[model samples]
Target: MSERVIKPVGRGFLFLDSHPAGCARIVREMSGQVEQRTPERRTALVVGSSSGYGLATTIAGLARYGIDGVGVSFEKAPTARRTATAGWYRTAETAALAAELGRSWTFINADAFADTTKDEVLDLVAEQLGGIDHLIYSVAAPRRVDPRSGETYQSALKAIGGAHTTKSLAFDDGEPVLQEVGIDVATDDEIAQTVKVMGGEDWARWITALQERDLLKPGFNTVALTYIGSELTGPIYRRGSIGAAKADLEQTALTLAKDGVTAWTSVNGAAVTQASSAIPGIGLYVSLLHKVRGLETPVQQSIALWDQLTGEAPLDLDDDGRIRLDRWELTDDVQSAVRAQWESATQDNIAEVADTTWFLSEVRRLYGFDVAGVDYEAETEVDVAWPDH
Candidate 1:
């Protein structure tokens, strides 16, 4: 081990700008629901379990629901070398905290996209927890490798046909100015590669492997998180390479449902996950939504995601049968409000316009660095190492 080095504390609030008490309340409330709903004997597996939405799902599972869990993540471990990812530290702390409650937890630091990693997870399940009753698929990666050909691939963003221009927010200085981003209208090979990387193949493989290994308990429920953005992100997201991946994911849900699993629907979760943040021109949209409700606190903005997860709101499906998280937020009334505000915004109208600083800050806080209560400067010495690779 390398000698510890002193690092300055991270400044500002971490996570969505919610009061510690309120955020704690939400966790406890959700935990109550989990305890009441899940059977004492049940177990769960959360994919992409190390960070962002995955971390939230794990928190809900362990902290709120009383269900023991196995988390699979492609996370780096803490090191004197500073190689660990943000999720690594958070998950480590979560595991430590969960242990105090006598709740079982396992953190796997292997690539979820790999068949080998899936097999290791199954082996662990058979050896320890027996089987999984609930599976939450929350993995979001920008790149993937084919299990067979060993081909590495990265996804792209492209315009539908011709180049188009749009305005995006600059959270650093809260302004929405017109800009341009383009994609190379994917070639057939490129489309296939995108599907290969972000597609449902890996998910299906995991399910199939667990089923074959007799590791999935009957009545197994699985959820895949996806997004269908508003007209604003259509060119860059909804109609782009990623959209194709999401379509495959949705279809895979129905296929899994047909496999006799009791619930296999994708939740079309809120677009606050790290995956959504990567979508071009999304910061402004988030800021716009925050302004719609006159939201001043981060918890209020974050409550929507939890609402969908636990509140059981009906999923809004588009014409093609995709759940529309973005469109639902962009309802006629909501859009009218956003558009009106957009029209009124000017170079000099920072106050009248949505403040995107909160939006950026919230996403950054999810990494567990910026939140208030946590002391970033203190040497935790607590191992933030990723699970064994």
Candidate 2:
């Protein structure tokens, strides 16, 4: 037996098998956090449910709340010569685990930005799940094509106000190196396009489509994940083009609230994910965040969100009417520590100032590497199938 040698490929990494033990560990952790469950059986519809927070939410809903789920995602499948995306393997493991626990689950591998995908989800909820009690929108993409207008939009991570310079981590020959990254201000068109692609427009569209089909259960709740980081990365994250999109998303939530749907914008903490790793300067900031605040994993964060949404107490909201799941990361002491580290982080001292080793391990784990109890040297099946419910 030879150890599985996974390597970075294009924008994603390749790995043959998902660690079942690792997946189960995450599910158990999420389930253990549930103090109480809803009295009535619930069903959830999750968009972008293959990876990151989306995947964690799906697993937590089923394992903790006993909620059946229908997930919509776009992920590549395995081939004879290559492995499937990590999300594909993760979803397969999730389905198998859900089946083992007698939980209902359905997953659709398709583009959530398209009308066809929305229609398919609506039909699934209408015919199989009856109606959805919770709708989770957690899709993050670089580009989107409008189904109605046939117009394409690409999201940008440029600073909104002006040029900004920050320290960034770049992988050089499989090693992390600190580099100075300067981002130019985004153009007006770029800002508009970023808002179009990453904003809550598609989320609003999905809600409207579900409403038209009457697939939303009475008193159903919908929430879309957003991020508002501290000042350290605010130029490219919280106060950048992505920030504009989030503002638009929050506004969308307001409009949806008026239409009798409980819509919320959940401001989440920054964590290492395929999406966040691509954002300039985020890798370094997250590394510092991990060192300072012991940032929570997506599974932990998802459990927190679920607990808030279904807790015995009413949903906790900030003064702005948004759920502040990021308060832990935004505390004064944490921010001060992160700022001190950010100012001193350099190529020569980054390793001492931040937990780069842990950050790198987390990145590898995203692609099914570094899982405990998984024999990397053992032969494993690459062509895994989703469980039949």
Candidate 3:
């Protein structure tokens, strides 16, 4: 007899929205990367620790490697009637679990771009944990509102002239259908702004701050996650504005190496993460990675990110100090097979070109709606309070 209206308190904010079981699964998966026999007390700092690859790294540090950690994020909690974002709730839950397991940790809610935020993080790490041995950066944002200038900087993806429409896949439904989307060619200022927010400048700043504070230990190790898809999805992603930012990231990794900082980028195999799903032609790519890895091992198994973080040898890294997991390059043979199919792909050959069953099912699983062993109809709730604005 009543209609409840929901106007969320924070801008684009949510609370208690992560699938607990899935978060656990990912954390457990990452923990397996820690060698069984090694025993050591390690301290870590994970920037962008709330979701996606950043969260995965944090989980690995705690659950798998038995390392205590400090997490820096801007994660907000969910409001009533509005669903919470996955990272917000998962971070809270993960912290709770880690506590029960006797892991020492700290999670900070602060804008990483600000000098004040960076200093605060450094202070926290130094006071509580002594110093950091590992640092992981995994931040991706659409825009950066300059704290000082009060100017809003927005990011764009390069779409060719005119409106571009392509066959988009929706996980809720198993279909590859055409969806009309438009993107603007970036002006010089827009490109600079996007790069500033997403590029290595901020990453370098974070490292500098920690080092200045003497918060970095002698065996300092750091990892930043990056991505590269096959040429088939190049136009919409790899060659787009985001791709440009990633290029900067790759270059930064190389520069960090020159500085004597042990830094490596892990080009992760595609999985449905909050950041990756936002990209244009990524649905099909995620599907393929899942299908191929599923038949063999989970995405976590294929990625040696946790190994790299723990200083384990034999973890593969590209020439420029980044791990290449294009999924296309996994088996070499597997990539060749996909390339052949994609080259001959046409609207008529959509079914043959794309594996509809795998892609569609993975998409649905992204929203926690179609995941096996998950009861989608069951009512779920998570309790987390994002810091006030």
What overall lDDT goes with each candidate model?
Answer: 0.61, 0.81, 0.64
Ranking under lDDT, best-scoring first?
2, 3, 1
lDDT score at residue 91, model 1, on the 0-100 scale: 61
- Model 2: per-residue lDDT, tens digit, 199-242? 98999999999888988888789999988998988898889999
Model 1 per-residue lDDT tens digits across residues 1-389: 33233332333222222122222333333333332334265588888876555666676656544668789887655444453455666666667656866788888888898888888889888887899887777777878987777989887665555555555654323233433444456766766677777777888888888889988886576666666656766777767777777778878877766777533434342444456666666666666767775432222222333334343355444554443334446568877777776566554664457756667655655454335565544544434344332
Off by over 4 Å in 2: 1-39, 387-389
lDDT, model 1, position 274: 55
* Winner by lDDT between candidate 2 and candidate 1: 2
Runs of candidate 3 exceeding 4 Å displacement: 1-37, 148-150, 159-166, 171-184, 289-303, 327-332, 343-368, 371-374, 385-389
Clash pairs (backbone) in predicted model 3: 14-77, 14-78, 15-77, 15-78, 15-84, 31-64
Model 2 / residue 361 / CA error / Å: 0.6
Candidate 2 or 1, higher TM-score? 2
